[model samples]
Target chain A: MSDKEEREISRIKEVESTNLARDDIRELVIETKKAVEKDNDLLANKIHRSFLDNNIKSFDIVGAIGAGKTALLEKIAEKLTAKFRMLVICGDITTRVDADRIEKYNAETIQINTGRECALNAYHIHQIIKNKDLQNYDVIFIENVGNLICPSEFVLGTDKRIIVVSITEGEWVVEKHPMLFKMSDIAVINKIDLKERLGTNVEKMIADAKNINPEIEVITTSAKTGENIDKLLELMGF
Target chain B: MKEELTKIEEIIANPNEIKISNIQELMEALFAKLKNRVDNYIGDYPTFIEPVYLEENVKIGDDVLLGPNVYIGANSEIPNYVEISNTIIFDNVKIGENFKLENCIVAKNSSFNFKNLNMKNSVLIGAANLKTELQNIGF
Candidate 1:
């Protein structure tokens, strides 16, 4: 077997051991959504293999309108721009504001104007970039449209999935949106700089997240303060 | 957090979620069913006839008749004048008033309004509300 295939096999085994041997139906749903990106598993798997074949790392950053998805990506780009050639795809309802902001950080930025659609679709992603030569980029970050629900159901065939939830959104968010948390590989509880003033229960949100998906890794950071952004980068293996 | 689900991605990844015709009977025949869990809203419990299972944080409303192989999950609210038998409900279910269910399976995070009517042996679910959940983002 090729190196990637062996790595993929081991990864699947690791996931099965941790996730499948329990009554965690939510975890099951997470795994289910991986292949079945809205009943287009065939296409989703093809997209998955293409990324793997090219040896490129892709992540879909999901969050709300003001949850700091773009800010966090900008922070990462600043620190790792020289180390890893990166591509940032910003999805928005109409504006290219986010894409413009990220481009200033020296990482290549592509703006996807979703128009009236609330989220990004996997087929659209594949079709839009099929002709582009992705060889120069080692990592690609696709910042999803700024809504929590519309993006949860679609698996964009990325290597990893990250969800950003801010303290400003409140404590109940982690528990309220089990679907998002369950499907995510990492949860970034952003905007910690405002914690003291907001006085929201960050611990409760972390606890709720751990309770929902034991396999999910949680990171607390404030992109504005530059606090723990290095930790996030280290966690992301940059 | 920011997000969205595509049309194809809206299709259920789990085969069990497929709404087969006669799912109620299929549930009985195969002994396969859903167990609803709750953590958000709750209700009052007025009565339990026999062999009822209630999970942690379950709330039931007044004048509700339950039990005899009925299971109401955690954080689930069964409103007033509701009767259930031989059914399994999953978590965070928001139920309506004046309803009746028998030998049925209700999925998690399901909320609907049904009054003075009976539902039996069916698999019912409402898609996860990512739209409303945007509230948690303070959007």
Candidate 2:
């Protein structure tokens, strides 16, 4: 064979090998991500089982911004503080405002700043629980970051997952975010006091949530007026 | 208040602490102590513009007022006439005009187009188009 032909063939082979190596690296990255997610789920489940063994009930409350999750939590903490010892873990992209608010109710609160992450994974909860004495509190409430879409994908090993949606978010919010309802154990339609002002159809929204997840218990609440808060506490077995 | 009173009573009952007969005097001392503690805590809070951490390629438009304790992440755009106070705006966020944001955490890649809207103590995720006023004024 000629020297020129051999050199061209070798260069072609080198280019093909480089392309193959790039493809392999991409696949490895994707596989690694999936494996990490699986490990997170396993760790979350183990933590949840540990809590159950200790007879502690934990809840993960998730919702969008301005959906009244923090307000609902404040009401719950205020009502339940007299009877039960509770801990609140407030998750946000940044800032500890929610934790500071919950602390005003005399509950031990921890703030998990997820930085740029939209959801609170099981790993974050695991880190917090591993350091703290979990037996001190009978109930733990994890207020996930103010997001509807991302929190549904990450299960933080809670006994109950509550999705709070308000009338101010528009009537189609439930229909738009069905996965949150499907993953949640209870769906709270908050801000019932603004129903008249917003002209929202609360019943239809609840129906839509139920259609997505039939087993989800739907409740209407007005955190401002303190309506149905007692019923919510009762349902939570406070 | 009840909890505080209980703590004060416990303190009064202790032999190691100073004994006070009048409840009013004890309460006044406790109030002063609380005020001092609160003042110290407030002093620790980050002042606006003191801890302003901006990352790479952040674009701030004309007439934007950034208040204290604000952190603007990488590649975020702050347009004209926006007042942000005690807020953390994450990376790749596109903020529009005439918006007042206080005590907010705006997540990454969120877009906002609003005018004269006051958003306080809120977390904005994804895309938000806030239109507060109706276009047509009824004659």
Candidate 3:
């Protein structure tokens, strides 16, 4: 082989050995750049190529139990369906009943009864979607088993990892789980309508969240009243 | 007959064990057992094993390493240099080249589609789940 081919081969081998190497990130940025200079949107193309290339686009909505994630997800799912074929994966440890609630949307839904484990791992999530005809839908919403800690550790092949926080969950929550916010592409503040009664400082919350993840997009909404729902939908790439 | 014999052995092994109050719990136990068996089987399953297991309709590329308990349904075209271990890939799906997947799926590409987690069309770098939503919602 020529010198160039040898170098490429050796680079691939090195990449394979250190799967978490920064070179992969560098390559991703380079591809994004190429797609950009060619008069095309790299992010959009990457989003679409993500399907053709990786075959996985999983995202999880994580928050504390009272963050109103279920209602927020219901609202988001409604908007998500208008632009993209959507499936709502409801997670609970005991019942298949959660799937029933989301089935009315007429989208495929899966109930991951994690049993004793609070979090759903990548392996189990993979098993659940292996037989899905992916061309049928555009987005998949994984409503993680409601907990702040365990679900953060597993990667389920999502295109984006999002965190859902309600204003009432308190200010310290942002400072507490810096890594979860670091991993998320977006952070959603739900139940904004309750900000007054709950004394939630939106500015403080946003500031704290941004301090943890500078580039993270934060959307405030009230699923109960459908306030700022459209903006949330738009941010979700609807 | 062998399957039937094992069934009988399980019956005899636990005569009064059918009263579990939780179906999910029971399934979890069964799944764990199956996963353990798959883990051990991969260590000893034949290296010459075929990529397409059914009687017909399977296409696979060269230098692919497929481990035990891997299920590739009919009409699935998995391209070259893909490593699938303990995965269930469905039919009529086109898996790209140089993909490394273990305990994962080309889900959404399957017939038994559900709302479970989908890792399709995305690459995961190093990340961890966090305990709070405030970690990254601002700015």
Give the top-scoring candidate (DockQ): 3
Residue A123 in candidate 3 has what lDDT?
Answer: 49
Per-residue lDDT of model 2, residues A53-124, tens digit only: 878889999999999999999999898888778988887755667877888887877665554567877866
Query: What are the per-residue Cα lDDT tens digits for candidate 3 across A1-238?
Result: 9999999999999878787666668888878766544433333344345455644455678877778777877776666655567776666654545556566655566555444467655544544455456677667778887888877666555677788888878877788888788888888888889888888788887888899999999888898999988887677665
Q: Which candidate is the best by TM-score?
A: 2
C-alpha lDDT of residue A184 in model 2: 93
lDDT of 1 by residue, B3-121 (tens): 11121112222435445333344333322222211112233324442235567787777766663346666788788878776666777886777777766666667776545646765
- After TM-score superposition, the amount by which residue A114's alpha carbon in candidate 1 deviates from its true location, in angstroms, is 1.1
Off by over 4 Å in 3: A1-58, B1-139
Error of 2 at A144 (Å): 0.4
Share of native interface contacts recovered by each model: 0.00, 0.00, 0.00
Judged by lDDT, which candidate is best? 2
Query: Candidate 2 chain A — worst ten consecutive residues by lDDT sum?
Result: A108-117
Q: Sort by DockQ, best first: what order?
A: 3, 2, 1
- lDDT values for all models: 0.70, 0.73, 0.57
| Whole-model lDDT, model 2 | 0.73
Which stretches in model 2 have alpha-carbon errors above 4 Å?
Answer: A1-24, B1-139
